[model samples]
Target: MASRWVLVAVSAAQLAAGAAGQVIALSEGRAFDIDVLGFRGSPARLGRDSWLLGTGLSAPVLMLSVQAVATIRLAAGSSRGATRVLGSLGALMTCGYLIEKEARGALSPAGWNPTTTPAVAAGLTLAVTMAVLGPRQASSSS
Candidate 1:
C-alpha cells in the first residue's frame, strides 16, 4: 500500500519535472522540435508563441496525461504486462530526450542539466519501481 503511494508520488514528480522544463524552455524562447508521437509522428517546432500558450498544445501534455492515468492504474494494482512495457518505454524515451537536448545545446554538455536532472532522478526511481514489481502474475482464471 505504502509502496504504491511512493510510486505514484515519484511518477507525479517526474511528470512535474517535465512540465517545468517545457515552461522554462518556452519562457526562454528556446526553439526546439517536439515529437508528435515520439519518433512516430512528425516533429513540430515549439517557439515564437503568438498567444502565449507555448507548449499547451504540445505532445508532452498528452504523454504526461497518459502517464498520469498509468500511475493511477499501477497504484490500483491492476497494471500488468502493458504497464511494464509502457513504463520502460517512457524511461527510455526520457533518456533519449535528454541526450538529444544535450546535442542540441539546450543543455550544458559539460555537466548535469539543472533543469532536467530531477526528471532523470525521478525517471530512474520509476523505472526501478517497475522493475521491482517484476512481470505480471499468471492469471488465476487460467
Candidate 2:
C-alpha cells in the first residue's frame, strides 16, 4: 500500500542519514569519539571497524521494522505497539548521539550522530509523529 511505501521510504531515509553520520565520524578520525556509557577508548583506536558496519547495519533493521509496522497498520488500521517502542528507542538513540557529539566537540557521534542536529531532530520528529499518528487502514483503492 502507499502508506507502507511511505513508511519504508522514511525508514530508509533515517538509515541513510545514520550511515552518513558514521562515515563522517570515521572520516574525521574520531569514530567512537563518544564514550560508550562509562567505557572509554575510541572505536577508531580500538580497531572496531565493525562499529562502523553496525551503523550501516541499523538501516535495514529500521527499514524492516517500518515495513512490518506498515503491514500491520494496513491490516489493522492502526500502528502497533512495537512502532511506539521503536519510536521511543529512536528518540533515545538520537538524544544519546546528540549528547556524545556535543561532548566530542568538533567530532560527532555517528549512527545517530548529532553533529547534524537538525537532521537528528527531524528524524526524531518523524519517528514521534509516525508513532503518534498511528496508522490508518489503507484504502482498498487509493
Candidate 3:
C-alpha cells in the first residue's frame, strides 16, 4: 500500500513536470527555446514546425498523462501488468530524451540548469524502478 502510494506520487510529479514544460514552451516559447535548447534567434523566426520539433510539447505531455493515469490505477488496485507497461513506456521516453540530449552534448549556452537534466533523470529512474518493482508485493504474492 505504501509503495503503491509512492509510485502514485512519483508519477504525479512526473506528470506535473512534463505538463509544466509543455505549458512553458507554449506560453513563452522563445524563452524556453533559448534557455533549454540554446537557440539564439527570435521566437517568431523559429516557425511552427521548428517550435513543435524543438519544444516536443505534444508527445511528451501525452505520454506523461498516460503514465500518471496508469500509476493512479495501480494505486487503486488495477492490473500489475498494465501499470508495468505504462511505467516502462514512461521510462523509455525519458531515457530517449536523455540520450538525445547527451548526443547533442547536453550543453545549455546559458549554463547548465540543475532543474533540467537532473529532474528528468530522476523521473526516469523513479519510473523505471517502479516498473521493475511492479505492483504491491502483497498483491503480487497472492
- CA lDDT, candidate 2, residue 75: 45
Q: After superposition, which runs of candidate 3 have C-alpha atoms over 4 Å from their true positions?
A: 30-59, 102-110, 114-122, 135-142
- Global lDDT of each candidate: 0.47, 0.43, 0.50
**Model 2 per-residue lDDT tens digits across residues 50-87:** 24222211222344355345445534543445344444
lDDT for each residue of candidate 3 in 17-97, tens digit (9 for 90 to 100): 555544544564422223354633345643453333434222244465566667667667746655565557655655544
Candidate 1, residue 26: how far the Cα is off, in Å? 1.5
| Per-model TM values vs. the true structure | 0.53, 0.46, 0.56
Displacement of residue 58 (Cα, Å) in model 1 is 10
Task: Report model 1's TM-score to 2 decimal places.
Answer: 0.53
| Best candidate, lDDT | 3
Cα-based lDDT at residue 5, candidate 3 = 66
Give the Å error, residue 113, model 1: 6.9
Off by over 4 Å in 1: 33-44, 47-59, 102-142
Residue 107 lDDT (model 3): 35
Q: Which ten residues in a row have the lowest lDDT in candidate 3?
A: 50-59
Predict model 2's lDDT versus the native: 0.43
